[model samples]
Target: MNDPIRGTARGSAPAPLSVLDTALAGRGVSAADALSGSIALAELAERRGFTRYWVTEHHSMPGVSSSSPAVLLARLTAHTTRLRLGAGGVMLPNHPPLIVAEQYGLLQALAPDRIDLGLGRAPGTNQATAAALRRGRSDDDFPQQVVELLRFLDDDFPEEHPYRERVYAVPGPGQDKENGLPQTTGRPSVWLLGSSGYSAQLAARLGLPFAFAAHFSPDHVAGALRLYRDRFTPSAVLTEPYALASFAVMAADDEHEALRQTRSYAHSMMRMLHGKSYLVPTADEAASYPYTASEQLVLDRWTNTVLHGTPDRVTVHLDRLHEAARPDEIMIASVGHTPQALLRSTELIADAYTLPSTPVPVSAR
Candidate 1:
């Protein structure tokens, strides 16, 4: 097989690649099994030289098992070594800043430098679930909440600040000496995730790393990148702008087989668009579904977001995306009919990119 991803970017260094798993439930597979699959995939990604293994947050979705990224990441920490595990991300609007800070602070305390907290303003579920999660709170406070969360994480609140003395982000920056707990130095690497210019500008102004969700929302990628770059300023977290763009990909040994794997993903998205249960259908089931002309148009648009082909062909498409987006890293979101197929697609892409495999360290668990 010809390696299409062999060369470096056009006049630039080869960008790092990472994996984003949503733990999509397959046909006849239980949610527990899907989560196990995610763990297996993360283990594979670590051995395959992938930079990071990120799990997504989605609530009330029967197809996705990753409703709580923090909880899942805690489990993943004991299962794999050398792979940066994180929420990619935790929706900020769904929880209070203090709670988010403390949870991730504990995670960092456990894993040290291997934890990342990618924050997003969007709710990770449907309207009903969002209401339940937020209780009656408005999302208008997102920017302020972000600032508060960062302050708590860094323990940078000034003496005059109202919450400075009253609230300490326990197990975080300011630990109580009376409790006899050793002061922790672990701090999570924070990244802002978004699909629009609003988050791009905020992330830039805050000087944090940014990850754009171009895998689903491709319309605003270029503009968001430009805005982030133009508005970025040096901060405590970063000296320069670093951006990662995610894309849905499914590579296989043959073009026909690759396209076949994507049918389930397309059908899943179509079901979501129509407010139906978003369970991932089998490829055979997806193919058998009747489609109206309008529905076919929707499916075509949804499936177009996915890069499905043989490894060589997929690599070329990824390279073009890299050239156009100029992101510092490219994150792959691969979904398939079966666990083996998904694993194979990820392996093929990693191999095409010439990623060096590393020996998995003994499980810390």
Candidate 2:
């Protein structure tokens, strides 16, 4: 099947690539250093022809420092000139819709058309942190929250709506009083992020671009994308289904080095699975740690989900993934013990695909 968004048939070639950063902070790496690494990664991604650099939201994880995507994206705006900066994504259930609108509106003001607002319903954290962040708010109202958020972003609440004329999101869509024609200060591109069929249906109904969380929920990727495309309805924002799949990828100079990095990342995942703090261990630490029978089973399962090997090996797997899912774009979430490892993976993947060294203009994207 042909994908209108990319103007290509499935499996013909890889689609546009992007980055999904977690700002890993562990193995003696400070939070500040992790953030700096993210900035450097963003700069390199832009130069390597990646279209977007998106930061994911996670809280109470000792190894992750990208808890506030909007704040981190604000910093990213100052570092890169052409790359699209976005939250991949902000957990909308954790904040008021108006607040989300205002925050992203501010980003648009800073970077204009380069800002993207991807929203998710998940808390992006454990139960206790979710409770603290939500303050007893119900997550069942996610659909309605999206509606209200869109109104604020477009600044187009109907006349009968209570928020119309009573409240406003500054730096958002508005009308010119003199001519009465509507005007907007560059509204950011809005995308719906999901890991299940529910979010896929919602994104379809809302006519927004959809991004599947394939990095973690690999089992649900195909079903979610199928539901998204099958039910998609056209809207002003999107005329056709646009779907992106995010994968956890790690590439290295050799298969052995990649496996070493994978083990380090898997050790962190195992700790989180066992309810321990998600502080990533160094490769040597992972190699030396004694693993019980059950832990080895768990590590083997998690390791299978991560695409890791030499650049050629990883690229082959990515191609197979593209052939099966046919996503309009692929977003990479690289994992490693150090910033240099992640950077090297990114450089290798870009070179393997022969990605341009020049920036892809906003219009072209």
| Per-model TM-score versus the true fold | 0.93, 0.93
* Local lDDT at 113 for model 2: 80
**Candidate 1 structure quality by residue, lDDT tens digits, 302-323:** 7888999998778788888888
Residue-by-residue lDDT tens digits, candidate 2, 15-90: 8888899998868999999998898899888888787889999999988899999999998787777778899998
Candidate 1: pairs in clash? none
Tell me model 1's lDDT, rounded to 2 decimals: 0.82
- For all candidates, what are the clash counts? 0, 0
Clashing pairs in 2: none
**Local error of candidate 2 at residue 72 (angstroms):** 1.3
Candidate 2 Cα outliers beyond 4 Å, as residue runs: 1-13, 175-184, 359-365
